[model samples]
Target chain A: EDQVTQSPEALRLQEGESSSLNCSYTVSGLRGLFWYRQDPGKGPEFLFTLYSAGEEKEKERLKATLTKKESFLHITAPKPEDSATYLCAVQPPGGTSGSRLTFGEGTQLTVNP
Target chain B: AAGVIQSPRHLIKEKRETATLKCYPIPRHDTVYWYQQGPGQDPQFLISFYEKMQSDKGSIPDRFSAQQFSDYHSELNMSSLELGDSALYFCASSLPNQPQHFGDGTRLSIL
Candidate 1:
C-alpha cells in the first residue's frame, strides 16, 4: 500500500518564524509528490510537485525539497496569511485506472502575529 | 487562467435522501477527480474519470457513484445519506501527466 506520513501534526509559529514540515512516503514506483495548502472549510490549493530526488521548488515564502524517501515543505519567514493546513500526497506509478493520490494527515500551521 | 468549478457550494440533506454534486473541469483538461474530506481530516480520494470514462476509484462506498460527461464535467451521486457522509466534496481537473487544479468544494451536511 502506498502511504504518506506527515510529522508535527500541529505547529504554532510566531510571525516571521521559519520551520519545515516533513512528509515521508512508501510507494511501489514513485511518480509524483505534491504539496497543497488548505484553509478552514476550503478546498486545497496546489503548491508544488516534486518528481525526483534532489528536486526543489519555491514560492514567495515557501520552498519544497524532495528526497528518495521523503519530502520537506520549508516555510521561511512565514506570516499570518500563511497559516493553513499543509498537505502532502504521492502518486504511485501504474494502476488499472488513472493515477490517484495518496495523502497524508496534514500538518496544521498557525502563524501568530 | 480559468479554474475548475463546482456547483451547490452548500447542501443540507436528511438521512435516506439523495444528493448530486457537480463539477466542471477547466477547459482543455480531460481528467477529473472527486475527493471527500471529513471534519478535521485530510481529503480522501473517492474516484476519478478520464475522457468521460471511469479511471480510478478509492474508498468510495457502494451508495456513491460518479461519472464524467462529454463536456468534461462530472457528477457524484450519493444515496442513503448518513451522518458519516457529511463532508466537504472537492473536484479537481488536470491534463494527463500534469498537476491537478481544484475547485472550491461543496460542503454537504447530512442530518
Candidate 2:
C-alpha cells in the first residue's frame, strides 16, 4: 500500500528560527512529490514539486529536498506570516488512477512573533 | 492568472438529502479532479475527468456521481447525505502531467 507520513505533527518556533519538516513515503513507483501550504479554511497553495531523488527546489525562505525514500522541507528565518499547515503528497506512476495523489497528515507550524 | 472556480462556497443539508457541487476549471485546462477532506484529515481523491471523459476514480462512494461537460466544467452529485459526508470538497484542474490548481472548495455541513 502506498502511504505518506509526516513527522512533528505540530511545531512552535520563534520568529527567525530555522527548522526542518520530514515526509516519508512508500509507493510502488515514484512520479512526483509535491509540497503545499494551506491556511485555515482555504485551499492549498502550491509550493514545490520534486520529481527525482537528489533534486532540490527553493523559494524565498523555504527549501525542499528529496531522496529515494523521503523528503525534507527546510525553513530558514521563518516569520509569523509563514505559518501554515504544510502538506506533502506523492504521485505514483501510471496506474488505474495515474493522477491521484496520496497525502500526508501535514505539519502544523506555528511561528510566534 | 486565472484560477479554478467552485460554486456555493458553503452548503447545509439534512440527512438523506441530495446536493450538487460544481467546478469550473481554469481556461484551457483539460483535466479536473475532485477530492474530499474530512475534519483534520488529509484530502482524499474522489474522481477525475479528462476532456469530458471519466479518466479515473478513487474512493468515491456509490451514492455519489460526477461528470465533466463539453466546456470542461464538472459537477458532483451526491445523494443520501450522511453526517460522515460533511467535509470540504476541493476541485482541482491542470493540463495532463502538470501541477494541479485547486479552488477554494465548498464546505458541506449535514444536520
Candidate 3:
C-alpha cells in the first residue's frame, strides 16, 4: 500500500523563525511530489511540484526539496501571514499519473507575533 | 484569469438526503479532480476525471459518484448522506502532467 506520512503534525513558531516540515512516503513508483498551503475555510493552494531527488523549488519564503523517499518544505524567516496548513502529496501510479494526488495529513503551521 | 469554481459554498442536508456538488474547471484544462477534506486533515483524493473518462477513485463509498462534462466541468453526487459525509469538498484543475489549481471548496454538513 502506498502511503504518505507527515511529521510534527502541528507546529508553532515565532515571527522570523525558520523551520522545515517533512513528508515521507512508501510507494512503488514516484511520479511527482506536491506541496500545498491551505488556509482555514479554503481549499488547498498549489505551492510546488518536485519530480526527482535533489530538485528544489521556491516561492517567496517557502522552498521545497525532494529525495528518494521523502520531501521537505522549508520556511525561511516566516511571518504571521505565512501561517497555514502545509500539505504534502505524492503521485503514485504506474499509468495515467494524470491528476491523482495522494496527500498527507498536513503540517499546521502557526507563526505567532 | 479564472480559477476553479464550485457552487453552494455551504450546504446543509438531513440524513438520507441526496446532495450534489458542482465544479467548473478552468477553460482549456482537460483534467479535473474532486477531493474531500475533514477538519484538521489533508485533502483526500475522491476522484479524478480526464478526457470525459473516470481515471481513478479514492477510498470513497459507493454512495458517492462523480461525472465530468464535455466542457471539463464536473459534479460530485452523494446519495443517502450520513453524518460521516460532512466535510469540505474541493475541486481542482490542471493540464495533463502539470501542477493543479484548487477552488474555494464547498462545505457540506449532514444532519
Local distance difference test, per candidate? 0.93, 0.93, 0.89
Cα lDDT for residue B35, model 3?
89
Tens-digit lDDT track of model 1 for A1-113: 99999999999999998999999999988989999999887788999999999999999999999999999999999999999999999998765335888889999999999
* Reference contact recovery of candidate 1: 0.62
lDDT of 3 by residue, A1-113 (tens): 67999988999999999999999999888888999998999888889989999999999999999999899999999999998988898887446624578889989999999
Q: What TM-score results for chain B in every one of the models?
A: 0.98, 0.99, 0.97
C-alpha lDDT (0 to 100) for residue A43 of candidate 1: 82
Which segments of model 3 are wrong by more than 4 Å? none
Off by over 4 Å in 1: A95-97
True contacts kept of each: 0.62, 0.40, 0.62
**Candidate 2 residue-wise lDDT, A1-113, digit = tens:** 68999988999999999999999999999889999999999988889999999999999999999999999999999999999999999988774332887889999999999
Ordered from best to worst lDDT, the candidate numbers read: 2, 1, 3
Error of 2 at A72 (Å): 0.4
Query: How big an interface RMSD has model 3?
Result: 1.4
Q: What DockQ does candidate 3 score? A: 0.70
- Candidate 2 yields a Cα-based lDDT of 0.93
